[model samples]
Target: MDMYTFPFDTQTCTLTLKSSGYSDKELIFADVNNQQSLTTESQQNQTMGEWELLNINASTTQPSNLVFSQHCITYQITIRRKPMLYIINLIFPVFCFLVLDVASFFMNASESEKLGLKVTLLLSISVLLLILNDKLPSTASQMPLIGKST
Candidate 1:
């Protein structure tokens, strides 16, 4: 899984097939590329809300039968979300505030007014950070890149 996109990511997962009751002598997969030997697809229950299939590939591996050697299939999948509202609500205002803060540097405000502007911006940014703290995954192994940039 490419989790760098966290909450919005795609993944390639593998499914391994093996015979538990019989070893390679009794039960062995034929040509791994043969679709009939592996799995089948049903059109009725195809897609899910968060994920969709992109492609799939099948392959065979060398038998190393301590317990059971396995055949494997790889699935390529894409993740989907409805993030328009999230971007508009959480990102737009902060972007506007940052732009305004940059513009304020060139304005001809007095020293006291300029200091007040900076302070106001700082407070707003702090509030945004606090709010974002709750929205982000606390158990994430590392800080999110978006949070680092912010």
Candidate 2:
């Protein structure tokens, strides 16, 4: 499951553990037999991409006796994005190329010089796009906001 926000934001994901053919009555939950301890172990050891763990909350839910269900323990993990370095290192160069392109438009050059400048800018932007395409999230439904803006 991809938990990506379109515009460079952080998100939290909840993971639940439910067993088959097990209920609160059959599988008693106590200080010794509980999921809270497991949750702590998971949070301490688990690592997700580029996101830093902010907090983890774990809780148990006892289902009604009427329906056959397993005891559920929900683990909510909050993560924050670490995108500042990438923006400066990868995206800043693209912005510079864009500015150069815009400046080329205002330059009073000969037809050949202008054509050469346009070609160079196009090639530079194309190379930047190719580099960025690999770094960006391909599974996203829409293009990245930065790419769209530029």
Candidate 3:
């Protein structure tokens, strides 16, 4: 899995089914009634936690080697993360803090009080950064855009 795009990323996974002992002549995989082998109704009713199912494509392949040929049924599934959760839990709070930080300049207060409020907001933003770090993979090839912004 690639984490460069992170919370807003779309992922495609492939699943292949084949019988090692049976050759293409002996075993065949086909969709019933020329319809999708997997039912969308069943997939629609199921929830994938943070990921939402976007598309499913099914195809058949016959790979021949020196020994024998095997029939394989492959399913390619595309899913996207439900970003609303991250936006609410991570982004919204940081945005609110920034707004407050800007508003603090307009408040009628002592210089020390404004400094203290700014410091508090900075600390709060750092805490949110830690939370974001925990959610991202440690060994990602490139940092996500959201992470880079933070």
Candidate 4:
């Protein structure tokens, strides 16, 4: 599929529309999950679906505003993937910091011991962050590429 970007923000995307018996509200009622593919042959050849980024202002809600018209009934697709580098970078260093914090508790307390232990813990955190940062992929990708920014 060609890269697509919605004009605006939309919580949901509905697909597979028909010119007849199609209601802006009711169309969302169909079980789009069972739908496998979308075709616009005999269909209206219009947009049966829409790109949210295309939303003009917040006035339009239906495909009428989004696509001139739409054909095709509906289709279903699956989305899946593993945790991204952001997730790894976020949780990994935080996890290591916590581990180091817990480790600091094991140190014995004394005059020089207290000073050394605090310095050691701070150094450990810094080192852990450096190690964690190094482990992350370069080029600096954005966070939560899907939903939210971590």
TM-score of 4: 0.32
Q: What tens-digit string does per-residue lDDT give for candidate 1 at 1-150?
A: 344555554566666665657666677676545443233352235664445554455666656656555553333233344445446656787898999899888978766788888889999988987887786546655664555665
Segments in model 2 whose C-alpha atoms lie over 4 Å from true places: 1-7, 24-49, 65-69, 141-144
Instruction: Report the number of backbone clashes for model 3.
Output: 0
Better of 1 and 4 by TM-score: 1
- Model 2 C-alpha lDDT per residue in residues 1-150, reported as the tens digit of each score: 332444356678998877776766688644225456655676688675677666667777856764776667777777777787568756788778878889888988756788888898899888877877776666755555554545
Quote the positional error of residue 87 for candidate 2 in Å.
0.4
Q: State model 2's lDDT.
A: 0.69
What is the lDDT for 43 in model 2? 64
TM-score of each: 0.51, 0.71, 0.79, 0.32
What are the Cα lDDT values of the candidates?
0.61, 0.69, 0.79, 0.44
Best by lDDT: 3
Model 1 RMSD in angstroms? 5.5
* lDDT of each residue in 1-150, candidate 3, tens digit only: 777777789989999998988877887777534334354654668675888877778778777663888777887888888888888988799889989988998987856788889889999988988887787558777877777866
- Candidate order by lDDT, highest to lowest? 3, 2, 1, 4
Off by over 4 Å in 3: 2-5, 25-28, 32-39, 107-109, 137-139
lDDT of 4 by residue, 34-97 (tens): 2223222313343433321221111122355544443344433222222344456556666676
Please state the error at residue 113 of candidate 1 in Å: 3.4
Give the candidate number with the greatest TM-score.
Answer: 3
